[model samples]
Target chain A: MGKVVILGDKAINDGVSAHEEQVSNLDALHGLVNEDLKAVNRVILERMESPVALISQLAGHIIASGGKRLRPMLTLSTAKMCGYTGRRHIDLAACVEFIHTATLLHDDVVDESDLRRGNATANAVWGNKPSVLVGDFLFSRAFQLSVADGSLQVLDILANTSATLAEGEVMQLVTSNDTETSEDAYLEVITAKTAALFASACRLGGLVAERPSQEQDALASFGLNLGIAYQLVDDALDYSAAEKDLGKSIGDDFRDGKITLPVLLAFRRGSLQEREFWKRTMENGEQNENDFSLALNLITKHNSLDDSFDRARHYGSVAKDALGLFKDGPEKHALQDVVNFCINRAH
Target chain B: MGKVVILGDKAINDGVSAHEEQVSNLDALHGLVNEDLKAVNRVILERMESPVALISQLAGHIIASGGKRLRPMLTLSTAKMCGYTGRRHIDLAACVEFIHTATLLHDDVVDESDLRRGNATANAVWGNKPSVLVGDFLFSRAFQLSVADGSLQVLDILANTSATLAEGEVMQLVTSNDTETSEDAYLEVITAKTAALFASACRLGGLVAERPSQEQDALASFGLNLGIAYQLVDDALDYSAAEKDLGKSIGDDFRDGKITLPVLLAFRRGSLQEREFWKRTMENGEQNENDFSLALNLITKHNSLDDSFDRARHYGSVAKDALGLFKDGPEKHALQDVVNFCINRAH
Candidate 1:
């Protein structure tokens, strides 16, 4: 027991109180894993510090912005579920979160987003250049962290995931305005951009644990599915989530010309008029809230939202099935809970 | 013996006739570094190829817009100079070029200019989103290339340089609208953003060659000095360069409210009216090409251009002096040529 985890259940619950049952589930696991959680928190804080003053400031802003810190939690929980007894897991966990934060910062800048996590985005507050550069800084730091354990395998996992993430971002950037974006294309983009990193997080935990090869594969698969589920839910919430809950305007993605799965499905299923509405708003970047609501109406009429939810549920089930490959443990159960939480969450 | 030394008296003159110089350097280096250079080229092209058609199209657009691949050439030259026989130097060389290109793409977007390398910039053809995302993609690919070497030292060198580059960009972004940028601060920013990577390129070459520690230090120092001289000359050219020769618009930096070394010196030495003039134009981004002549007048009267030239010469001399640590050879002489070329170029 070289590392300790001091779970911040109270803090997380305070932020996510509306889902009291979900919070309770997380809290119970936090209590059980509390002894080992502190190491993760320490790794994150220490690794986020940089010689660059601007990076230090913006990295602090993002880290202290009070999101769920879910990716790191997944890494930690996966390692514990695998019955790991190593300190490297903390580094791996922090590395995952750093990768996530780096992407978030860059994404906000790319989206020219003003709000996230119920606060002004780093770009909105500090400016886009700092957000982009500090994102690069965090990414470099994450690479350093990934190599800390001298695991070439971990490096390979992260390096591939990082490249995939960038590729997905480029793909999304390209297709953001193209009316031809299909459901499959949207899935491919999100899986690469979002799910790939999440999958890497889980895979890295298994690697740190030195779990059996079979279990490691299962964990990675579980992570991949959960990531897909999580992103689908996010896409769904884009249409339904309030500005307060989502931290950005409703249809913000559409406004930014991002064609997510729900919209893609709706476009495919909609009549000529509905398709025209999407093209006019998203492709031309001409939509206001009124057009956005009309588009939502078309999505509902076509049951496109339902189709996206079905896919999310499918991925969620697959994610849980991945945990069945692991032996019964609090960590495994927590992983399962995460999968459920991803698909079911409103925001 | 494994890597070719591609050098000739006419190689630099090949810029006026791309065909003549292309044959000299690429073929000569290819013959000598055929084995390693091929691997390097492979890494670059392979990583650059995308399953998504649009990204690959955009990447091809920027990559095909030729510039003198000076930084990679240094890597190849130094690796051979230090007697490295391994193939890894090739990949490392290409990685340096990738990083350089990525920065150029992003800089163009942030600066919002149209021309580069005597042709269209990525942003000009594809828009800012593609340019930004592709820049990120190239960066990610460069890191992947670095990781392939499995050297933590190489990773650290590249990672630290990447961070420095980002920090430099942020610093520049912050001071872009300010007229009070000191020459020292200008140097500091360029050293981090531009020189650091050049130094890292040479250092990576030394690492590849596994040269003695002192020689490695000398190579890195040489690169830093040469890179600083290179950028200082570049900044000076913003005022003195012919529009056709410079590719980018003359005084484009001033138009973007960037306070480079000469401009900073000019502002400091100018009278109160001149200071007010600078504040309205360079600080407020109110200047036009009509103001270029006046700005040039201020620069010349204050001898700011001369001062900038002197600073460049100092860096060039330091760079040439650092070559004393290398063994006497044609490669060393060629390296010296780079320093002279950087400091003495008209454009």
Candidate 2:
């Protein structure tokens, strides 16, 4: 029997060189999936048009803002890996992107965020009302695409994922600004908010290819772990990355008092003074000019950034293991590279 | 062959007595559909519960705020009138109510209006973030119910209605504060925003009952015209009704600078001085303390309120004519009475 080899601590602990290799791998994967990605982009642009000029203008602004297109890439690459030869994956990939964009619009409104991906958010430019309504339009448009695809299973998964996404957002709202939030509670939030869609997108690959249930479940597991790892890296990067590199200002999570994983780890390892500072700033909203620098010092002192990355590496390994059933191919290698890229991106 | 009788100028000219008769007819129709409505109410309350207390609290506030459950009633009554015997209609009716409530939540956020149905809006009570998110939850939940019903036709109609509703809202946003918006433009907005759902709800009745497509189209036409009439009466009431009677303050449309049919009529009939007044207030949004009363005087002088109701009555007659294909029964009469009630309810 062929044994599945999972990336270990040594692979991740190699640090800068390892991260560079993963970045190059991601670039190669993007090149491999370039044609399918272009089709998905075409689908996205075609679906966003409406007789109402504001909708097209607002939706076009966000859709064209140029995020990594990672979610749709997951859908496209996974479907191709699973031997999906038909055109449905193109539409489904676009549907996944629409769902992501719709959430971003609403998320900006909910977060009252001004800038995203180094640009003014739709809410910031068009005002909250249009952002909220247009977000809804995109969401409806996503479902319209799902129905046109004529897959009850896809509709079921997308519909359930949407509800979970909303529920997860509400869960985050309930847990926001509460310094006492537990790791498990934080995990629950990320699972529902981020991982659910990822899992669904990956599952659609096996589902459309008519793979066995076991294989579909494996794809879903791979996606869920990858999503968790990706979000963990994102939380860690909030404290460690430069403003230009991260595409937004650092300490936004701090300003918003969001209770992310690194904060939780740092808080657990914090000294009495540091803990008190977190309570005052995060819980009581008593932030000041030097607080962000102080926060970095406390996190660095506790090695919380490294610890958070380690946790992400653990999930990344699990994601890698879940792909054991799939045979070797360019598509499979690209998906595996995606897992590594997600874990090492912050470096 | 029995000829279909359509209401005309003489019926509307009867005025108060005709309005009073319509109210009594609506009361009787409500009495007839009470049981199905109760079941739908139960479904709404049941579905609104969530582990997140704020979701249930916020959703329950709006769901129980006691607006006339008119949309659900349309679904239930039409389904029964079309000889539907299954429980799917009950769930579908609940789904329709959910879609309506979801829109109301989003609409309140968009309008930034504090009061709805004589109570604070969910956005007003819980803030806009929760309202926007919870509205999404309800919309998702509506789709969940549609999926559970296992009818692709129902899903198609509801999904399309949702997209059209969002498009209509965006159209309204574009046209807000623009005094030059044409009557055709106004009708287009109302048709997509309000009438599409009504048409869908009544069509669900035929779909669930497995009625012929011709009969379904008739039912849809009935609902479309009724919805147009209902919205016209509502717009006129914003100017002409007392606050206590209307359950909302007068001049809301004026304050928001929404270009409704009454304003359009008044603008068309106004002299140069009156036109300038509208341009200053409605277009430039430069309103003073006496502007609402001035606007009302202009509308009254131009007989715009009466003309708007006349327009409403015209649609009501079309709604009645569409129902002529259905056999005479309590369901049919109640539906016809609903058309009259929609037109005459402003009194």
What DockQ number belongs to candidate 1? 0.54
Candidate 1 lDDT, B1-347, residue by residue in tens: 00111234332332313334333433343345445554666666777898977777877787656565677877988898898877778888988988888888778877887878657788888777677778878888887888888898888788778878877887888778789988788888899889998898898889988888898899999999989998898888777734324233577787788889888998988899999999999777776657878888888889887788789999999988988977887677777767766665543
Q: Judged by TM-score, which candidate is best?
A: 2
Model 2 Cα lDDT, one tens digit per residue, B256-336: 989999999898888989989998998899999999999989998999999999999999999999999999999998898
- TM-score for each prediction? 0.90, 0.93
Cα shift from native, residue A159, model 2 (Å): 0.5
**lDDT by residue (tens digit), candidate 1, A80-170:** 7777887888888788888888888888878888888667899899877777778877887787787666777888788888889988988
**Residue ranges of candidate 2 with Cα displaced over 4 Å:** A1-21, A241-248, B1-22, B241-248
Clashes of 2: 0
Q: Can you list each candidate's DockQ?
A: 0.54, 0.71
What's the lDDT of the predicted structure labeled candidate 1?
A: 0.77
For residue B328, what is the lDDT in candidate 1? 80
